[model samples]
Target: MVTLTMDGRKIEAPEGATLLKAANSANIEIPQLCSNEELEHYGACRLCVVEITHKNRTRIVASCIYEVAEGLEVNTRSERVLNVRKLVIELLLARNPRHPSLLKIAEDLGVKKSRFEAEIKGCILCGQCIRTCREVVGVSAIGYEGRGINKRVATPFEESPPDCIACGSCHFVCPVDVIPMKEKDGVRNIWKTDFPLQKCESCGRYFAPVKQLEYFREQYNLPPEQFSKCTHCR
Candidate 1:
C-alpha cells in the first residue's frame, strides 16, 4: 500500500493503481468520459486531468493514466484544474451537443453552451466497442479504418465481413449509443441482414452468426469434423 495526499486529504492506495482508481476508491468526485470498467484505460477524453506536485514541481496529468506514487501531492479540484476541465467540457459539448451524458457533465461544470461549432461525428472513435469485440469476445468484426480525422469504424472492406460473429458485444460496449441492435422476426440485425438460424450440419439445431463458425474453422485450422461440432451442429 502507498499513502498519498489528494486535495488535502491523505488516502491509502495499492501500488500500481492509477490516480482515478484511487480517487474512486476514496469516494472523491472526478468527472470523466471515455472510461469503462470492462475495457483498458484510455485517457482520450482529457476530462480527468488533475494537478499533481512531485519533486517541488506541479503539472497537469490525466488522472486515468497517471499512476499513484508514494508521497504524491494531487489536487483534483484546483482553480486551474477546474478551468481546464470546463474548457474540455466545452470542446466535447461542441462536438457532441446532443449526447445526454456530455450535456450532464457540461451542466455540472456550469457550461451553458458551447462556443465552437459542433464536431459531429457518428462515432466518437473511442475504440471501446472495437477492442471489447476483439479482445474479450474474440471477434474482430468491426474496426477502425482510414486515418486521422477521416477514420471510421467498419467491417473489412466496409462490408459486413464474413468473420463477424454478430455477438452484439460491440453494441453493448458503445458509450454514445451509436451502434444499435435491431431485432425483426426473432432475429438480431447489425447493419445488413438479420442474424439467421444457422442449422448445424450434424445436430441440425439453429444458432446465431453461422458465418462465425466458418471463420473459426478457417482461422484455427480445425478439421471438418470440428466444424460440425460448432454452435451450428451442437
Candidate 2:
C-alpha cells in the first residue's frame, strides 16, 4: 500500500493507484470530466488538477493520471489549484455556455461567466465519446478530424460511417450532450442516419436499434426471429 496525505488527511491505497483514486478513497471530492472508473485514465479534462508537495517541491498535476507516492502531500483545494480549475471551467463554459452538464460543473466551481469569446459554442472536444466508443464499445467509427482551430470529431469523411452500430455508446458518454441522437415513432436518429427500432415481441414496445440487432444477429449467427424479443422479454 502507498500512504499519502490528501488535503492533510492521511490515506493508504493500493500501490500504483492514482492520486485521484487516493483522494476518492478518503472521500475527498475532486471535480472531473473525461474520467470513468471502468475506462483508462485520460487527463484530457484539466478539472482534476491538484497541488502536490514532495521533497520540498510543489507542483500541480492532473490527479486522475498522477500516481500516488508514499509520503506525498496532496492539496486538492489549494488556491492555486482552485484558480487553475476555475480557469478551465471558464474556458469550458465559454465553449459550451448552453450545455447543462457543463453549466452545472461551472456553477459548482463558482464560475458564473467566461471572459473569452465564444467559439464553436459547444462540444468541448474532450474525446470522452471517442475514447468510450473505441475502448469500451470496440468500435472505431468516430474520431477526431482536422487540427488546431479546425479540429473536431466526426465520422470518416464527415459522412455516416458504415461501422457505426447505432448502439448509443457515443451519445451516452458525451459530457456536453452534443452527440446527435433522438428516438421518435420507433426510429432512432443518430449522426444523420436513421435506424429502425425493434419492438420487443412480448411487450410491443421499441427496445433496440434495428441495425444493432442485425449486427448482433450476424455476429452470433442468430436467426432473424431469435432476438425479436428484448432482453426483458427473453
Candidate 3:
C-alpha cells in the first residue's frame, strides 16, 4: 500500500493501482468516461483529469490510467482540474448532445451548452464497444474508422462484417447506444444485418439470435438439432 493525499484527505491505496482506482478506493468522486473496471483503462474521454503534485511539480493527468505513486498529492477537484473536466464535457456534449449520460454528466459539470458544433448521432467515439468486442467477446468485428471528427465506429466499409456472430456484445458496451442493435417481432437487427431470432421450443418465446446460436453451435460442435430450442427450453 502507498499513502497519498487525495483532495487533502490522506488515503492508502494498493501500490501500482491507477489513480482512478485509488480515488475510488477512497470514495473520491472523479468524473470519467471511456473507462470500465472490467475493461482496460482507456483515457479517451479525458473526463477524469486530475491535478497531481510530485517532486514540486504539478500537472494534470488522466486518473483512469495514471498510476498512483508514493508521496503523491492528488487534487481531484482543483480549479484547473474542474476547468479541464468541464472542457472535456463540453467537447463530449458537442459530439453527443442528446446522449442521456452525456447530458447528465454535462449538467453535473455545470456545462449548459456546447460552444462547438457537431453532427454527432449518439456515439462519442469512446471505444468502449470496440474494446469490449475485441477484449471480452474475442471478436474483432467492429472497429474505429477515419480520423478526428471524421472518426467513427463501424463494421469494415460500414457494412456488417461476416465474422459478426450477432452476439450483441457491442450493444451492451456502447456508452451512447449507437451500435443500432434491436429486436422486434422475431428479428434481431445488428449493424446492417438482420438475423431471425429463434423461439424457445418449449415456451414459443423469441429468445436468441439464430446467428448467435449457430455460432455457439460451431463453438461447441453441437448438432443443428440441439440448439433448435433456446437455453430455457433445452
Quote the RMSD, in angstroms, for model 3.
1.7
Cα lDDT of model 2 overall?
A: 0.87
lDDT of 1 by residue, 75-140 (tens): 999988999999998887765678888888889888889887888874667788888877776767
Q: Which digits, one per residue and each the tens of the lDDT, describe model 2 over residues 1-234?
A: 988888888889998999888888788999998788778888987999999997899999999999989889999999999999999988888788888888888888888888788775478878888888888877778999999878888999988888888999999888888887999999998988888899998899899898888888887899989878988889
| lDDT, candidate 3, 61-152, per-residue tens | 99999998888999999999999988889888877789888888888888899888865657888899889888887778889899976888
lDDT of 1: 0.80
| TM-score (C-alpha) between model 3 and the true structure | 0.93
Work out the TM-score per prediction.
0.82, 0.93, 0.93
TM-score of 2: 0.93
lDDT of each: 0.80, 0.87, 0.86
Residue 163 miss distance in model 1 (angstroms): 2.1
Which whole-number lDDT from 0 to 100 does residue 56 have in model 2?
93
Higher-scoring candidate on TM-score, 1 or 3: 3
Top of the candidates by lDDT: 2
